[model samples]
Target: MRRESRVERSTSDMAGGNRFYFPTKAPESPAFYTGRAAFMDTVDTLERAISHARRILSARQLLPVPDFARETFPATKPQWKGMGNMFNVVGTRMRPKNYKKITSLLNQLAECYNVAHVGDAPSVARATKNVLDMFGRVDAPIEDLEGQKKPVTIDDAGRAYARGRRKEASARVWVIPTKTTDNPSVVMDPEFFHEKILKSYRKITELPTTSVLINNVPLAQYFVNPADRERVLRPLKLTGLLGAFNVFALSRGGGTTGQSGAVAHGLAQALAAHVPEADLILRRALLIRRDPRVVERKKAGRAKARKKYTWVKR
Candidate 1:
């Protein structure tokens, strides 16, 4: 009893070569055999694929590689973000099915990684094939499509014009670059300024100011509702072209809401025309399309479009 080393104690417990011994202190747990094995396998497969793709994509000097390290599962956001940027650069022309499959696979991989790390193997195995497939094709080249549309061009007036309609409202919008102005300075109406800026200054004396006019009135003054104002400015804001152009819109055949919507649609079209490159952004935002919804006519016997009066037995 003077001293007994761990090795000696372990050897004493396993007296025979045929029998195995587990120390009392080292309690047996299913996690040792079940969770870690599959988790490490899945992670290893994914990590290898990711590394291989990264090496292949390293040739793209402009694309920065995502930071990936072993056991960094908890911090996978940057990896996904980096992957997204890379995908944008090379996945635009990828077959829709492939694109969707790859996206789903990445999502599954993230989910499976989390679940597997927590000792759930069955759940993680569900999407293993999909995740592997995604990792395999992460570096594939995008295919080119035929007959690409030509970019829109600005007119002689240096303005792009578009028409938009919403409900009974219709609008004609024109967008012109602020840089084309011959005047050295532009005098803006007090109401045109944002509330935050308006509170600090009586008047703004600035060059190359963006102006939005609706029916010869400033945007803020015309669209009193904040929602309406936001709707009118959404296209520009989305394109990061806000305050870079002058917008003139003539809206008719609708109230505030309709008119605002019409102007927004028109503005979006005009912006697309001015900056042909931004057409994709405008299209995705659904700002280029004319809203087809209109008010349904009231039925003669109904309270409103589809409502009927409650029956009262006499």
Candidate 2:
């Protein structure tokens, strides 16, 4: 839980700026992690960051450490408004499919040592309501046939357990949300990943409304050549969105797939939020209208949950 600073801390009258404490892995590995020098008023930022790092560095006593393709990079806590104040959590896709998990998130209303996060509490409540309501839309199990209103509420949670379906939406939502990470130390959470990654992924998979974002704009040139079809997929069936209309998306982390998914997902959600009915079209088109939980993580994970698991072609 404690790491000694390796990089030499320094300050100079030449550049005359905030002091910095950069860190590196071991001598054998490439120094993939580093941060800019900045002022620190509290240890809160660094402590929160290391909590996640502790899980990654050795996986601790929680769950098995996921096998990411590359070394997990520790984030540099930057100085940005409303950045390090709240916890950084990754959004996930399992909620719709897993009610127990949804319930668990709802039940976790901040335990011992974890005081009330009222703002976050409402979010969790809303998510719980959504999953429970949507479950009935597909698998209605209630036979009450009497007391029911328009939009469901927390009181409806218990009923959902019986009904087995939400009164409104379906659980098959092409765009599933999964909370993947929670780093409280980060300053600027690149909006590309925090906002738009999953929407793009769902759009590609569901084929509802077609959207494209170049995350790796640098890779755009490959599509220009047309031969890199290997890299930039051409229009096809299973290749889904990855085939046709190559979207260029460039991002720092959460992996290449995560970045693409976020862009596609965010785009779809935006369309739905602004244009209401567009979501139906998107779902029909096979591009799932994102559930809008792309950035909020319901549960903490090791490094990035999706990044792990080395490839196996078998």
Candidate 3:
């Protein structure tokens, strides 16, 4: 046989030998040529796969016809719809015509029972009339229930009463008006025969002096502090009624300061009661307001309120 040509020999050898031999006559590098061919083949395969998938998707768009087996046996009606009006359909359905008649009968029965057991129409009319008559009998205004339409007035004793409190101290105070004559009358008489002439009759009016007593003791004696004494007397001074009335206060509880405040509050109230016009003045001066300040409670693990115990690591 003639010597085999290189191309044919290589082709036959490749067909008979291992299928993975690299070709020598490739123009570009073998690795690049093989990779390029593999990439092109892969691109073709992907395009074919995409086209096939598109065809399947287009076919799926058409609706499926019902099978003969399914058409032979149709679905049954829903149980709820079949049950119909036998079951009451509350809010969903229109009320039956008998509902109105039933409600009317119930209302009539209730009215009849009320008339038979409670009373007849004429008796009801009489009861209503009685109520109207009773309402008509009330002639006085309802506000009169608060007894004593007028402002608080001093009794025949000429004393005004009031109560005051400050902290733990409380005082019951009474202010009494004092009577004083403004002028004095004197008359001299001459005796004719009798040895001694009768002493000339003289009537004198004295100026009233105001005094403040606390628990039956003088204010000065009860309250040692000058400030406390001044606080107790502040209300009278503010109202310009210092010498007008004598104050007797029974104060209990709390210290001297609190007692003084309590007494002042009581005196203010009494002054207001004594002279209604002074109410505005006393209120403006804040004498009528009760002091709300109190001592803070001591917290646990502390020496006193807000005072922490000293820590010493020994």
Top model by lDDT, which number? 1
lDDT of 3: 0.58
Per-residue alpha-carbon lDDT of candidate 1 for residues 216-307, written as tens digits (9 for 90 to 100): 99988988899999999888777767666999989999799899999998888888776667789889988888887878889999999899
**What's the TM for model 1?**
0.43
- Candidate number with the higher TM-score (1 or 2): 1
Candidate 2 lowest-lDDT run of ten: 157-166
lDDT of 2 by residue, 134-169 (tens): 222212223432223232121221111001111121
Lowest lDDT 10-residue stretch of candidate 3: 181-190
Model 2 Cα displacement at 225 (Å)?
A: 11
Steric clashes per prediction: 0, 57, 0
True lDDT of residue 130, candidate 1: 47
| Ranking of models by lDDT | 1, 3, 2
Residue 144 in model 3: lDDT: 40
Between candidates 1 and 3, which one is better according to TM-score?
3
- For model 3 the TM-score comes to 0.44
The regions of model 3 sitting more than 4 angstroms off are 1-152, 181-207, 311-314
Using lDDT as the measure, name the better of candidate 2 and candidate 3. 3
Query: How much lDDT does each candidate structure score?
Result: 0.63, 0.30, 0.58
